[model samples]
Target: MIKARDALTKIKPYVPGKPIEEVKRELGLDDVIKLASNENPYGPSKKALEIIDSYLTNLNLYPDGRAFELKTALSNYYQVQEEEIIVGNGSDEVIKLLSEAYLNPGDNIVQADVTFSEYEFGALLMGAKVKKVPLKDFTHDLEAFYNYIDDNTKLIYICNPNNPTGTMVTEVELIEFLEKIPKGVLVVLDEAYAEYVADTSYPNSLGLINKYPLVVLRTFSKIYGLAGLRVGFGIAQKEIIANLEKAREPFNVNLLGQVAAVRALDDKEHLEYSFRENAKARESFYQECQKRDIKYVKSHTNFVLMQVEDADTIFNKMLKKGVIVRSGSVFGLNRFIRVTLGSIEQMQRFWQVFDEIGG
Candidate 1:
């Protein structure tokens, strides 16, 4: 019999949002609303879906291992070279590749205490330690992060418009923080929710990737509405891409995901529509919170983290009412709950049940 590695014991697998069908079955309700994962409630661009449908007959062929067409499309859109881009199965895979390429035993990765869990899991998988600096006032504390860096720090993960909290580090703060860090340490800026950001204060992370030797991860999963296709890409210096390439499995991304991502990039109208809808609904959500006298964090992304005492109780209650929102206890923030912003009608429905429950 074989046992798992000691490092594997330190890692906990990620738990994604439950499917709507599962919730409906569990609660015995027909009107279930899922606002847990920050999925684009509008769904994918019709053109992208059509393109994917057209390519289904060719599933017998292996995917373009290099994802040439998709890389070229992303390169053209971002004004970066194709050589500087590396497409991933998802941005999740890119994080794992970065850890595989850079971390050695006992090295450390630094990130905010309650940001995305994948970064910590990536480091732990590589037999490395994670140094998490606590967030300040529900936001990334750049000064605190800078203070904690040491010689053994191999990477720093910055999730702009951070997960769970939906708070962002400002452009000014990010620029100053970048300048203070040394060259050898790679900064992985995860902007999976960047497209939903309406706040001008958020950092222009792509610009930093060009200026410094940083890696910027973006995904088709959010505003592009391609999460089911599992498409995402990273932009970095040519050397960084070359290093990460060593860890990638050829044909890691599927043919359908590549085709969908390429077409989605061309659908400017769909992209704009998602942006506008998220911004509008976010304001309404904030107003609803105000009306209820509930304390909530103002968000730059497509989700809001609202504070509630007995969050577990509220989560279970919401589920019983056919609404699925995330309980933040997994991130160790027991007092907070994260809800994805949706269309006006969907969000209005959420608040309706919220009001009925006297929450």
Candidate 2:
């Protein structure tokens, strides 16, 4: 076999949630509800769907390499200059781009131990060291993150309303943390689930971009329901964006994705409805967990991490019953399972299956 880069030895492949079709095929089930991935069950806006057909004829040509139209839309919406934004295949790609542009061997990145895995993956891929700070109260310990940074630290990833645990750092807390970060170190605020947060204290990360060496990542996947389209973007100071752009793949966002994302941004009704419904479903899940005396971390995102007697067993039981939830073992939280809050009807089905499994 050809010799691979030594960095591959340090990296573990990301295991995504089982798809609904894959579950049905493997288990011989007719129906399955997937709450494993934190995807918008409601799907994309009608306006976005309407524009897809019109873009079909142009598939023979490559998409605009810069994703000009979508960037313009985002610029108008966020009130940032077009030069300050970088569109990617997904925010996931933007993470990789940042790593490629900055990380070098012996350099290090700091992030919450149990937060999003991509931050670590990116660093490891570049042969950079990862310094993990344990979460305090299931939330990012900003103070501890500051302590982890030294001259070798090149990046810091803060997942607002962090993945798996769904916990958040307040605006005041984040601002304080940013103020303490050393100059030349880039702070990446991954806010993929920002639209789902009902908390008034969630930081306006976009507003802080100009003041700090910050990149705020947002996606059309969750709130705009364009996960399948694979459209995500990052907003930052033009200099930072220019550097990341150098490492980005040309035409990373597909043509249809660009058109759909632009139209999705215009669908205010769909955006509002999705946000309102997610809040309701999240609250309902919280009540259900409380009534059963199930321990759960309070969430700001559209998912909840609940403690169970045996998460692996519970996950398998739920899987067999046509419900797919993410076992927290992957994040090193062996006793918990992270479940995405679905629509009212889908969540009802989740509860029905969960109860049948004696969970």
How many clashes (backbone atoms < 3 Å, residues ≥3 apart in a chain or on different chains) does model 2 have? 0
What is the C-alpha lDDT profile of model 2 across 175-232, one tens digit per residue? 9998889987999999999999888888999889989999999998888989999999
Top candidate on lDDT is 2
Clashing pairs in 1: none
**Which ranges of candidate 2 are over 4 A from the true structure?**
none
Q: What tens digits encode model 1's per-residue C-alpha lDDT throughout 175-258?
A: 998898986899989999988877778787777776876899999999999998898889999999999999999999999999
lDDT at residue 155 of model 1 (Cα atoms): 97
Lowest lDDT 10-residue stretch of candidate 2: 350-359
Query: Best candidate per TM-score, number?
Result: 2
- Give model 1's TM-score versus the native structure: 0.97
Error of 2 at 46 (Å): 0.4
